[model samples]
Target: MKKVSKAIINFDDYVERKNTDSRKWSMAGMHEMATYVDDNSIPLWVADMDYKVPTIIIEKLKKRVEHGVFGYSIPSEEYYNSIKYWNKIRNNWEIEKEWIVSTPGVVVGLNFAIKAFTAIGDGIIIQNPVYPPFKSSILNNNRVIVDNSLIDKNGLYFIDFEDLEKKASNPKNKLMIICNPHNPIGKVWTKEDLEKIGEICFRNNVILISDEIHSDLILFGNKFTTIGILNENIINNSIICTSPSKTFNIAGIPVSNIIISNEKLRMEYLNEIIKSGLKPIPSLFGAIAVESCYTLDGLEWLEEVKRNLENNYIYLKDYLKENIPKITCGHLEGTYLAWLDFKKLGYSNQVLNEKLEKEAKLVIDPGEIFGEMGTGFIRLNFACHKKILIETLERLKIVFGK
Candidate 1:
């Protein structure tokens, strides 16, 4: 592994994502819309990083690609060991070999667990201004959503325990989805926070689904404690969804490590997966990516990535503060994402988002997409080179300059 300044990482050499029918890039090419801003803007909305994946992962993929054999596949014992090793090394929580059941992705695991644990109309709880997929997973699976809106104070995010407790105790609510080191807002819940959440869920009989996909992406100054490690009660109720995809810039690869410690949840979800009859072939190249990312050179590359995120976040914060004073992002504790609160700008969410897309030539995710509380906000992905970060911020300043 070579140590070099992340600023030297070239993003332009990265191939264009346009032709892949990427939702993050493609405007969907609707000819009927009067104003298609995606046509003009460079997208920073997607969660994927713009940096090149580590050389180790690239080499592993190359070896796999070189192999011409394409047949039904099974994850070897080493594959499962890789997942266990990652949890132990990065999360400080040793995973039982029996704990992990590979899934195609977290979204799929969420749906399966929802159906397996709770029936239709069972109330499911989630903190608001969270990852949009959490809400979608519940509703799309016919489970009711019980919003426990997080409290934001002075740019910091905290769990709304009063509200979460109320919802958790509700008889109709049977499941609560917890985003460990949450997305968009980037709050790495402390062990103390997880303690309260676990007790509340345990007492209320609410099944906890902990999405820890971003756990490994903790920024330089923060710590990410897995919810399952907080307490046995939480672990018993918890169905943890983790993947190398978000951490390794391989969402397109799509291999997820799904863990359910409780035998009941494990059995139920297993039944659902089989009933759904989804094929179980291993994602060969993706498997190689996960293996290399977790078992080899993961810690070293991870440290560099964390440094890159911290430096990028600081650059973004300084730029926005100096140029776009109205845009204030709260403390970003984990993940390379910044959640910008633009309420001071006095523009409707739609107007603000449109301005960014058109005038700024930047495709940012509007807060409204998260929920009503997200109306005055936008989620910015700063997981790119410093130069690109500077360009994105400068473009926004030019568009929103007073």
Candidate 2:
């Protein structure tokens, strides 16, 4: 509840990102970039924010850079202790240094988990219309994807518990990857919701991998319950993937903490990491950023950013309702990404892409890329200046209004 120094943190400041090698700004190599992107278009795609990270992180990195020793680096005791302190203060979860495993990124950790616990042909359950990487990691590993698609009740999403129970009960399904405060839809799984999922996965002897990258971005009075805080049995059967990337706007740092409590599973995952020829230590810069951003200082900056995101969400919903009533904006309980339903526009994905590119002159993630359930829903990143968000909404109003 402490206020950040407004002199340093300005949510309304517009920072230019073009020609900076930011993938979110540049469309090259993006999924639909070549087809729909032009140099002049504004980008609202990708999950990264447009604001600057906390000054503490920048100062720490600068101090490290001055040392001028780029030799091999390892995570120090402070790095591990910072992570432990972060979980205890922020998420109310107690953790030990022994349970922490450093990875280059959460997606990389997902692949390690897949290789470590499940066999090549084993079934891995994932909720559809979720993050695209969740499905690809399973398929790329030669594992079967069990779609426990979330039920869409109007604009809000709910878990299909019956379907989930059925899927978890399958003997072949050995693992499940859950997106807490799920992507695109932005529904934060409640404590009760997680407990139910824990019971189902635990009862079936299925190992759970909870992707909690967006756990720190909760909005609208919603709470995020870490999977490791559940029953002892459930906690023993889960792996938590966390990062400072999304919350601190430091995705380029390539660092994540994969927490595994069970000693056997921890060893198995570490074995996969070693077999992949990856050192357990994180990069020098990544280590500094992690240690700097997991403190009370970083929390203050994040609190301000969340307020800006909430305001942007309110403006987006209001703007669409008042002007472009055809498109429906889903509720955003967490994450800066907003899900907009474009089905009423009555266009195929290609046609919609063309319109969004040629008419709106904007870059946004197409819904189909997430899963079939995302066919006509586009995900828009609103973690930018209010002016940028307003410009985006104005473009949509001009294009979708007709």
Candidate 3:
């Protein structure tokens, strides 16, 4: 493997991604954006970052690629150890090798959990204004959706425990998926918050599937608490989905670790995967990348990325406050995605999206796709060069500024 660089890299340095089959850039990759704006428009949609992967991870994958042949692969002991080490050091969560199950992605793991734990016509509870897939996973599987919408006041978002309790108490509701350091809104649920959720799930016998994919990308001073760690009952009944793809910007390479402590639950979920004819091994490059990302060097690179993200967020937030006071952005506790409320401007979801694409010449995730509660909001991906973020703000100014 090539030696990794030790020098601090500039986060504002631009890397061209056009014509690289980038979903955030290419016309084919961003067909939705292409429909609204010209090909030259800037895209702030999608959850993946614009930055390159860590040098250590790239070097490791390069070494693997240098080997002549690509064939079927299985995860080595190192892969499992890397995950174990990462969880132990970063999240302070310890686990045995048997508890970890490999999946192509966290979303796939979520689907498997839904299939394993619930039947057709059963109800699945979810917090709205969540990652869109949470709704689709339930609906596509022919399960009923019990939405416990999060309450948004001013700019802060809170889980409506009373609504949640009511939804979970429905005997038909068999599962609930939790997004920690939540996407779009960026609320990192506290220990008390997670425990309340766990207690509700326990009381109603609703299986909990916590998506902690963004746990490592937490910003500000917020801490991420895994739902499985809240109690023994929660642990036994929970399926915690985690991945290095989001944190390391390797979403193209499929890899996720679904942790289920209970043996019976693990077997049932594993069986669902097998029945679907999916193998346990992830892509070879993904395995190498994941293992490399758990090292000390990798963590150092992550710390720098977090610092850059924090700086970018502050700049964007402050710019909006000073220049576009009508636009309300919530406190970004975690994740590179910023949820901006445009309700004050009084445009419907369609008009807001059109204005952003045509008027601003910028593409962003329309908030309505997250849920009906997300209307009049937009989710902007800020994991880019600071200059890019500055340009995005300028574009918004053209659309909404006086």
Candidate 4:
């Protein structure tokens, strides 16, 4: 692997993604009102980035494709080692090989955790204005949704622990899914926060499922502490879902590693996957992509990506504050997503979304989808080239400044 300097990593270089069946682009379709937008519409909706994948991973994929025999493939020992090494080096968290369970995706692993830990009709607690899938995974598995919605004050988000404790106290509330370096709101939870939540869950007999998928994307010098590292009790009772997809822009390649330190919990989750009729092995390309993404070259690429993301956030925040004062953006501690409060504008979700689509010709994730708390807000993906983000903001000024 070649070492590339930050100066050489061209995050500003635009890569055309239109008509590529991209969920962030062409595939968003009529359901998202994307079909009605013009061809030049700026899409800042999906969690995935508009940037290209790191060159190292792409080269590795090309070589794998050249082999041309895509047969049933199992994860290699190298794959497990790569994950172990990444956890140790990147997160300062030691993880053993046996503790890792390969899943097709984080969302799939979430469903497996829901099945393994909680029974049908059991309550699953989640912090709202969270990733939409957290709610879907619980409901789709016949589990009840118990929302411990975060408290928003002056554009910042904080976990409502009292509400969380009350929700967890319910005997039927068997599980809680935590989004570390939380999506949409982009709050990188602190050690203290994790410990408090862990204690609440431990005492209430609620199994904790920590979705640390965005763990690798800590922005603006914020540190991410995994719930597994909180304490012995937390580690014993928690399952962590991690992936290289979001960090490396390889989300299309399905791969996630579910980490469970407790032997009993690990086996139960594996059994649930087997019962679901889904093989535990990831796809051939998924294995290669994960391994490639944890290498030294990959780390270097990610450093550059993080810097670019930080710059993008700063640029967007300042631009909105100066030009579109009605829109308030919260401090982005992690993730490329920016949570923008539009309540001051006093527009309904329907009208706001329509104005964005028809007037500005832009597509962003409406906050209402995250939960009712997300009403009067919108989440913007600022992980594109700086030029594209500038254009999007200009469009926003045109639409909302009226």
Candidate 5:
């Protein structure tokens, strides 16, 4: 494990989103901002990080920008090969070249998968306290939502295999979406968990769509079990939607590769992606970001990010347990997000929002937005500089008014 260079990447070299109509920072202020209200809370609510994309990626993007033609660009083998090669090397999962399909983003691929396997009224099973988009994709596709909520023990969340088996075995359910190293709660599913889910879904004739967007972001001692490696049964039953977005902070580039080994399913998914025609630029920017993160400087930087997140998690855990003891939170094995339990505070979602807004002055994703299960659990993003994180915690401490 080599060290990632800590040299300060100049802020001036980075693109500032304050005025560019970016959804991340700008979404906080926009009148039509669907999720957040117009207020001044340092915008850490979204999944993107404040860290600069790897310098190699930046250089490649800059060189591509200079070309100026802006015509439709098609990437070479380097683009696709990097994805296949990276997954094979890092995950120990072998993906054939023909199995991979390019897409605008993982969420898009989810929609495509829904189209591929499910009818409009079919049911989709999702692990609750998950990435919110999973529900959106299911519902937006007019599919029924069958939530298999995770069991949170203290601050750790675990899958309830019995409950999962019961729900997945229901005949109405046609698809199961697994979030590897799930967002918000951040539990990296064990091989056993994956196998159990595979068995249940298969028994019920459910097609598995594993959203592995957070697969590469696990912490020390936690190995990601790519759904592809779970079993011959699950591999044949699943499609993996992955990308450089969360890991490399190039989400705006919005490129994801859907790797499906099942021949019939792969073709069906690709056909849907083409029919929807979502805007996938040559995304020279995304391609550059992927190559850089996959081949060169990313693994080390990821280690640094992992270390930083672990440190922050420890700091928050110690401080909150000692100081703001009333508020509870839970397992953070992957993703930059933390789900804090505010149920003990006894505030309704509306009142919690008001108190957090007026008192904490910290902008976090509201618990209610995640679903009934996420009620009273606020999601925090710890991907910023350490100093900013400390300040945010301090503000929250004051919100406790202790």
Candidate 6:
């Protein structure tokens, strides 16, 4: 792919987000326990990017807005074709039209999957520190959360496959949610790692739910292998939750593509959606956004975004090492979220939160919400202009640099 010129996409240009119903910029975006902040506070918490979405998507949406008739809508052939095109070109996976199920968001799809596949009191597995919603979805529906915690070897994280196998072997555990290019900690699972996970799920009668929302945000030469692209048997036994929302920074649009190749599982999932009275139909604008962003034209914008995110990560890592050596950040293999280790600061999670929010005036996702394993850490979203990232780093230095 050819490099995108700055003239085409000026990633460094700072865009104002405050007071625009922006979740990240609002005090409401923070945890209930967090300290209040004034206008000077910088929010690096939310997973959504601070940058504007691609011009191609903006133009497409504008055309639809001009139509001025907002009514009930269904997925178009163009929508399905766009999904197929993206997967084939990006992940090299060919998908059938019938296999695709449109969901409002990945979390919604997860809740429906849990309802469809497992009975009450059945166990659902997830690896943490991970996205917090994975645990909430299970408990909210009266299902069991069987945690297969990841091993933190130094700063880097690794899956505890042995523990996972034991959890899967148990008859009560009926499902497992694996985050590819995992959130909080930006570790992208290798093909071998995925194969092992798939084998465990296939053999144990556990339905695998692979959330690949961050697959397109891979950085620093890491590869993302979609679970659907694995062996035939594994593909039949798994569900892939994906979306262009994360890729193109249109997360507020609420669009996701949940792919299930197995006919029986797909039917069960659809049946659950119907029973719940929640139709999987995309909004007119949602359908247009997906169709617009999932094309070959969106590739240039994506590449440039990845590059900008990588540069931000590099800057954050280096700035910490030089200015505040007590804080350690792991290599960001994928995703724009940088997992920072602040245990060396000798502060409890409360103190850490206070220091960042109260003193530093930097609002970021405290690691504890991600799970117990994430305590003593922070998830900093780096998908912003360099100027914002620099200001964030300088704030950390002011508060934590003793």
Q: What is the lDDT of every predicted structure here?
A: 0.80, 0.90, 0.86, 0.87, 0.77, 0.89
Pairs that collide, model 5:
155-330
* Candidate 2: residue pairs that collide: none
Candidate 1 wrongly placed segments (more than 4 Å): 1-22, 27-35, 279-281
Which parts of model 4 are misplaced by more than 4 Å?
1-8, 29-35
Expressed as tens digits, the lDDT of each residue in 74-143 for candidate 4 is 8888788889888988888999988999898999999999989988999999999899999988889899
lDDT of 1 at 58: 73
Off by over 4 Å in 6: 1-7
Each model's TM-score?
0.93, 0.97, 0.96, 0.96, 0.91, 0.97
- For candidate 2, the 10 contiguous residues with the lowest summed lDDT are 1-10
Give the Cα error of residue 279 in candidate 2, in Å.
Answer: 1.5
Candidate 2 lDDT, 170-243, residue by residue in tens: 99999999999899899899999999999999999999999999999999998899998999989999999999
| lDDT score, candidate 1, position 333 | 86
Q: Whole-model lDDT, candidate 6?
A: 0.89
Model 2, global lDDT = 0.90
Model 6: lDDT of residue 316: 90
lDDT of 1 by residue, 78-124 (tens): 67778888787777788887777777888888888888889999999
Better of 1 and 6 by lDDT: 6
Candidate order (lDDT): 2, 6, 4, 3, 1, 5
TM-score, candidate 2, is 0.97
Model 3 Cα shift for residue 353 (angstroms): 1.2
Q: Give the Å shift of residue 101 in candidate 6.
A: 0.4
Candidate 3 — what's its lDDT? 0.86
| Candidate 3: residue 70 Cα off by (Å) | 1.9
Candidate 1 displacement at residue 111 in angstroms: 0.5
Span of ten consecutive residues with least summed lDDT in model 4: 1-10
